[model samples]
Target: MIEIKNLKKVYAGVTVVNVPHLEIKSGESIGLVGNNGAGKTTLFRMILDLIRPESGEVLSNGKNVSGAEEWKNYTASYLDEGFLIDYLTPEEYLYFIGGLHGRNKPQVDEYLASLTEFFNGEILKKGKYIRDLSKGNQCKVGVGACLLQRPQLLMLDEPFANIDPSTQFRLKNILKTENKNLGVTTIVSSHDLNHVTDVCERILLMEKGVIIKDIATSSSTLSELEEYFGVGQTTSTNTGIDNEENH
Candidate 1:
């Protein structure tokens, strides 16, 4: 479980995010929705210990996230494109990430084998540096690497940005299966309400760095989420294809 207490972030004398108390239970999938500059990414970074919060603490499984080496083994996160190692091929990148989590090459290869269909034989053996792959393919490779580790907590930011529609659907199913079957807790932030509604059991709406609404998926719909964001008219009905995959 993750417990965030009085979390706050400030940059250049400006407050970005402030959450007094937020707790995410193990194996739960939670979605965060907010407009640009609403500090959604900042919050995710704090949880991952990529950035320091101005105040408060984030604890996972009874250990503090900041400067906690043991917690590193249990948490896996991908915040943006920069997180990928541009010099490595997709297979190499997967192997490197799995190795960091104490998995061998054979284990990485076996995990990649299961995801072969999703890659269409284009990623695993392509022998191209990750920087050379298209953005969509890079997103797929990053997400695939994270899954190979099988961490207990996964945090993703804008995870559907550059993927094709078909792949997005596949990713949704993959996330659901991992969360349900493996009992992995996930926190995903996306502007695509439909994707969040389809996968996450809870949704937190942010406005100007504050959570304006928190609703359970069982009690809310994408349409209602659109209304809450005041973008109902612009909400995509394009069959879940209009998002950037940042997992």
Candidate 2:
């Protein structure tokens, strides 16, 4: 559903993102993993058209994302709390997003009801603006907004970073259900290795703004990744591992 070609982004003479070619098929659950300054979020921003690439293009359903508004109709992304309307309460923020998606009040309420377990009783009826909530609660609000859209393509950055363990597991199940049952194309970047591995069937390891590894997760995928990160590593060792068996 998404294709990237010759994508590159430079900052102050440093090349932060340089993806030559990448394609993500519909209903694919993808996990992007990398250390800090790896440019994972930069790549995501470009895909969402929040940042224009210095070269190349991002295509959604065969249309360049930068040139078309159609992709926004089916795409939902939440990278940070900046995506939220901080002045609005959680319910208000969600309702606004639902309205944009053509969902009425009743439909949004029903959907919010379904997220009781995921919210763990901290999100709704809090009586506080989104900016007043704690970091984890703010993240919950952002994720709730994304899910409310029932998007065809969902992208989240570091979604597992702020929430508690129980909420993390809940989110993993939600993502899996969205991909396997609803056929939503899910792309999530996370610092937690276990969370990403459990939810995604494919994993991309990035370094120095390059996709050095494209691994199809297997029974031993977690261990393989752990091993890769365990030892002090550098991009020079495995510059670009395109296939799964290399792991």
In lDDT terms, which candidate is top?
Answer: 2
The models' CA-based lDDT, in order, is 0.81, 0.89
TM-score of each: 0.91, 0.94
- Cand. 2 TM to true fold: 0.94
Best by TM-score: 2
Which stretch of 10 consecutive residues in model 2 shows the poorest summed lDDT? 238-247
Q: List the residue pairs that clash in candidate 1.
A: 159-245, 159-246, 160-243, 160-244, 160-245, 161-243, 161-244, 161-245
lDDT of 2 by residue, 75-94 (tens): 99988888999999999999
RMSD (Cα, Å) of model 2: 5.2
Clashes of each: 8, 0
Stretches off by above 4 angstroms in model 2 are 232-247
For model 1, the superposed segments whose C-alpha errors exceed 4 Å read 231-247
